[model samples]
Target: MWRCKMVDLLIRILPVSAWKDRLIQWHVPGCAACSEKLAAREEAMSVLVQERELVSVKDFWPVVNRRLRSGVEREAPPSRPAWQWVSVAAGLAVVILTSLWLNRAPFEEASADLTQKLQIDYIRIGDEPARAYVFQPKGVNMTLVWIEKDGEGE
Candidate 1:
């Protein structure tokens, strides 16, 4: 029944023991949750002990150790060559850089197209406003505005 957080947590994490009854009295109504949990825990442990009484640990370890040793493979080869992994990483980096460089043309063309279409008459304030860019659509009167700051644009 003594139920400080550190002490109660220690009881819950440990194996059940004869000292549990003393714990119940020590905590009492001040710690009902801990007491009930410990009682249920004790009951479960008693049942488990009874079941284990029918087992022979003296006759168990050799069979278990034999099974564990037998399952180990003695002939496994190394997984992969280091040079192969290095070449794969290098090739991936090159491909990414090449793709990024090649896509710049399309992006630049789209920006130019957007700039030219923005000069239409009555299109409302067609000048490139400071901190802003206007992307006007083809054959349409609509435009999208993006506000850009000192060194960043969003």
Candidate 2:
């Protein structure tokens, strides 16, 4: 019984060359179980081959062409919306305006608070009206003297 089971397993797994071995041939002829196993394996293989669908060369190109056309249509570029274009234009305008505003000098009174911080004195030297001021902070050795030439309105 053990030998019959082993022969059945070998018949299921062994290649054609192994099946043609003299020992397998002698065992398979007398053993009804192994012969039935071999017949069943052959029948199952035949049924599977018959049931499998094979693609013909004549129908292959038309199926491939249809798939390729569908893929190309799916990959076609979409149109942009009006709001998208408007938003892009608005963003570009904002960037340009911000850059221009950042580069421009600020408009403010020049000497609005300088007169209160520093002591102003006017003196005429030899015919020229000049304004002079000394900026010396407490406990500092550096003294800054600012003299304006031809003081007209400042």
Candidate 2: deviation at residue 135, Å? Answer: 79
24-120: candidate 2 lDDT, tens digit per residue = 8779778877676565766777778443465543658888889887896566554568678888999999999998777554321223234336555
Where is model 1 more than 4 Å wrong at Cα? 1-37, 47-82, 111-154
lDDT of each: 0.65, 0.68
For each candidate, how many residue pairs have backbone atoms clashing (under 3 Å)?
5, 0
| lDDT (tens digit, per residue) of candidate 1 on 17-77 | 7565566457655676655555576677876757557665567779878877997646656
Best by TM-score: 1
After TM-score superposition, what is the CA distance of residue 115 in candidate 2 from its true location, in Å?
Answer: 78
User: Which residues of candidate 2, in runs, are more than 4 Å off?
Assistant: 6-20, 51-154
The TM-score obtained by model 1 is 0.31
Pairs of residues clashing in candidate 1: 1-23, 1-26, 1-27, 2-26, 2-27
C-alpha RMSD in Å of predicted model 2 compared with the true structure:
28.7
